[model samples]
Target: MKIKDIVNRDVVNLENCEDEAIHIPGLIQPHGFLISIDADKEIINVCSENISQFLDYRYNEILGKRIDDILGKDFKETLREFKSNSLEKKTVFLTYNDQSYALTIHKSQENIIFEAEPNKVPLNEEGNLFESSKRLLSSIEDTNSLKELSQSVATAIKNITGYDRVMIYKFDHEYNGEVYAEVREEHLEPFLGLHYPHTDIPPQARALYIKNLLRIIGNIDYVPAKLYTYVESKVDTLDLSLSVLRSVSPIHVEYLKNMGVGATLTVSLIHKGKLWGLVACHHYSTKFLSQETRNAVKLYGYFITSQIDVRILNEQYEVAKKANEYVDKLSSKSLEFKRDSLTSLFQDDAIYQLCNGSGFSACIDGKVYSNGETPTEEDIRLISEVLFDIQSDGKVITSTFPRQNKGLGSVAEKFPGINFHMLDDTNYLMWFREPTIKNIKWAGDPSKAIEKDKKGLSPRKSFETFTENVKDTSKPWLQPEIDACNKFKFFFQSFLRAILTNEDKEKQRILTENLKAVNSELENIGWISAHDLQEPLRKIRMMASTMLEDQQRFQVTEVAEKRISRMSKSAERMQTLIKDILEYNRASSEEDNFEKVDLNDLLQEIKKELKETLEEEKAELVIEGYLPEVSGLQFLIKQCLLNPIHNAIKFKHPDRRLRIRIFDDQNHSKSDMYSVISIQDNGIGFDNQHNEKIFKIFSRLHSKSDYEGTGIGLAFCKKIMLKHRGFIDAQGQPNEGATIRLYFPKVS
Candidate 1:
């Protein structure tokens, strides 16, 4: 038994094998069973019909060499066993990835033999098709129905294989078929739910499928039916059953014949020992697949079928469980079992906890009773019409909302609603409940349980037994319901952020507008008050001028002269009051620009301006050391200090000369940007109660005979300080002089 004996002529390179000791023929299939292995259990073998190309390695080169030294590195141990055992015929069945192959291993005197044809396919998987298939299986766990599961599988296959189209074709006892699930390119039309008649494929074509478990039609247009030479019966020429593999299922031949398909790879889905369906992957153009690739795809098909079975079983369970849960949650809490109360069943946050349903609705008579979004009366009526059309016994239909209801086609304005047919009578038959909000009442007493518990010490003690059932945490968790219920959480978070931002911006805008209005009002108040009072003051001033002018001319009467003199003095006082009021208004309108002004230099200049008055009045004006620059309206601030200085000098006591001092200090207030400016004067000071009154326009504490001018000086000074975002305050009593403090913000 030599390796050369079984080698097929096509598989043997005579030129390369010239140095070999012997060559044996008619022993085994050449390419079908030559084992190639390396050290570290890395195996490379070709079970392919064209084995010659794969076994190009030198005979001696692979004897003791490791996979890294010959074939490759990091090969799975499972693959090493495949090549090693495949050579000895120890394993008659071959399993790669997940698909199992019933292979005949024939060992003759020369080499091993594998009696199985090979095929190739590209699983939509970009890389490592096995891993991709595993993920697809895991994701399929969430599939709800057979149709859904099939659809998921189709999509998964297409995604992993990068195929143009993949379909799950369900066949009946007859050859009739329907596309249960399908995934196609975006540009291609969907084949969902499209049914083809049984005669479309014919009976003879179906018989072929029974023999050809898996077939790869690489090029449908060029698929030439191979003549079976083993068939020697002349009378059974037209019978496809006589051949080892029937002529590519007559149903498929006819299907391709009608569809003009270019290529196809079909894997029969056999479940429970019965022909279930076929996972049909199609290509629109001539396609070529390596045998290795086809094997990978078959493995995927096997895994998908298993997953489908599990998912279908789980789906049945889920449906029953969900229906029971829904009935329990709604029936017990519903007011008088009124379905409309379902709208109030769950809070907004709880609505999102339900499932993949983004928005929810409960329809009565096909009319939406209530939903998360507002539904117009007409929309409700349309929905009612659709529900009315469903006369079945609470049968569920998985369909898009728009397709079910014409009124719901546009998702733009109206929120999409899913239809759940609850078999009920004509009267109040349907209740619109939002799926997103259903679970909310589960945690609390949906029907006034909280209010009922108010008299009790614990809220839980207040809830009814029915409420406890709904909130049972012991129940197993369902992902769909959770996804549906959690939608409310996102809605709440987003809504709060939007509203707060708008409100904050609105408040800021309002404040700015109000400040502008106040500023305008201040100007108008100043102008109106000053102008309105000037008229009376003008008349008085005119009368005084005339009285003084005519006093000597009309002096024939002494009593009359005295009265005229008094009238003139009073008129002059009135004019002074008017002037002071106007000056207070002017000070508010005027402000000085901030600049570096030496405090000591300013004080020195003021002293020089008033030196004569101070010298004659025997007043002493003193200033302290170097002053820092402070933010202020320079001219206004000067006027502010000047008014107080003049007042001190004017009120100088006859008993002693006046003393005035100006200085700055730290820790003036909580504000750090402000510099404190204080002036203290010892003179004839008024009572403490009159401090505020002195800063009011025309508010005179002293009689006209005592004071020399109108009482607007201090008021004008206060206005100047206020305009600079500053303030002024005075302290004084009867015998002692006053001290006035001014605060100004620094420019920098």
Candidate 2:
């Protein structure tokens, strides 16, 4: 019958078979009888319809009865012990009517299921299980190569099960199956090395294989026995996931019949919780294995699964070793050079052999470099864009056939395989492989494996060998090759970071030297300009003074005399500006003229120099406390002190006594870093907001008519303090008083 008729009605074609509820089939193979007891109540609730064939009572009569009523008190006690211990599953041998059966009990949902099948294998065969398994495991351990391990397993299982053919089938990344190793009877055609598409075993079947671990079909043509449940018990569908006598799918049976297989046994090999492959045994005629024999085979499968990871790693050890050597060489070379390291390394043969590629190409700093054989520039650019679209975390993107990507189909023939590694957005390295022709042998025509007729979809009715010439596809990239590329990408990125860091340091050093040279030239120009302007100012002052003296000789009027007086004053102010400009320049350029100066002695000199102005303004210069010695240029320190004291006397309020205090700030002297000296006066103080602005050259708060001096006085003070690595601060409010404090750095 078509699968749609016997299986779930939703399964009309192979595409929909993945959704089939094979785990809850509600039927058992006719060779065994199943009984489910309510775990909490200790009562029988479900049984196979064929149970009457083995026992005296029918399934209907057995259902809804207590376990002790059917199997006696001793059996119920055993069941209770099994439940209390919480064992996964237990198998016990039971004899009734002079017939022996293996009774397997396991928990399913809220029920405890008991599946019994006839034990027909000889006791001697079951007795040798442990020793035989030990020998098989030893053989596998001694075999270093993966192929040798597969062949040894196939040969050993065939000898144990007495099957016509035993094959070690392996699945690729895409779940496609390949007959990796095989041992068969001489009369049978060899099915070794034949490939099968993943569709042959849908996702649901693979999932069941992982869950159940092992399955055996005693007679492929045998009828399925339906399960019978008590109506009042309300068990809708029985879970046959852990049932050893679970009925096989009709579609699977039909597929096997087409291959002329009478019975089959499949053992799942699991690694890291995933279904790795299977040990498939096929018999040309009907066969059945006792529970003891099946358990022995399962133990062998477990041994193989446990060793799969280690064996695979052992196989790739040599490849990884060589890749490490290449990485070390490339990284060392990259470090030896400061620039063009990537460009130079890209030309080396080591990069091409790093991943065992036929060709290599690199895009660095907008330049493309190539070695060995590579695709055209245009094709390379297109491939790079595609790789960029899928780039992630410096992962190596590998493709066995470039044609698989729609954008790369046209260039696939030029380079069928590629390993693309993107270092960044605009730079990458790619390795390529040329097209290789392979003659692949499939068990059947994979393209037509699943056929549709008027009834529904069906398996192909052919097992004869089908060979096809597969072209434009290179040998697949191995995991070690991909791993090597990833390692190289990491080294390349690290090298670039190191190079960029060193380059930035070198650039900073060059810029610092250039800045120093530019400052020296500007200082020289300012000094020359200030010295040259002094001569012109002296000539102008002389001319105005002579005109003032000769006013009566020229009969000069009152306006004329005033004009001469104004010209003389203008020239005098110009002379003061040039003098202050020269002082500012000297402060910045004279760095080696530092000396220890006594501030008390310097203040006495300043008071003597300003004696005439002090007497005229009627100001009091009070030295509040003893001053400390500090290190600075002597003349610049004099100007630093002279400017502020003069301004304090000049800007004093007219209504108040011009009392000026000259003292060392005791609070500032307590600190070891700096000494502070303050000049305070009751003057027409400026706003506090102009504290910073007033220090700039030529910055004046009052007009020239009110304040008769160059605006460079405070600016000169700031520059001198800066030359001594010191600081100056101004604090005041309008019409109150102003205090200018100078902080001189302490000499160590």
- C-alpha local distance difference test of each model: 0.54, 0.82
Candidate 1 lDDT, 1-748, residue by residue in tens: 1122122233123222222112222222221323332223332221222333344454333433343453233233434455566543332344434434333333433222234323333454346666666777786676666777777777777765556889988886644566788999888766666555444433434544554456666665543322111111111112222121222432234446445567787777776665677888888887655554555666656765676657666765664455445434543442422333334653332242244333344443344444344356676566655665654554333333444445546431243333344434542222222222123212123333111222221112222222222111112224444332333334323433554566688789999899878977976876687678778767866775676678767453677667766776776776667666666666756645666766777888999999998888888998875566766656766888899998898887778879998888565673476777888888877788877888887678778688688778888887888887878888886668888887777657
User: RMSD in Å for candidate 2, one decimal?
Assistant: 4.4
Q: Estimate each model's TM-score.
A: 0.36, 0.87
Query: Which has the greatest lDDT?
Result: 2
Off by over 4 Å in 2: 1-15, 126-131, 334-337, 359-364, 375-382, 394-396, 400-405, 408-440, 465-483, 554-567, 593-748
Clashing pairs in 2: none
Residue 481 CA displacement from its true place in model 2, Å: 3.9
Q: Which stretches of candidate 1 lie over 4 Å from their true place?
A: 1-543, 555-567, 650-656, 666-672, 684-711, 732-734
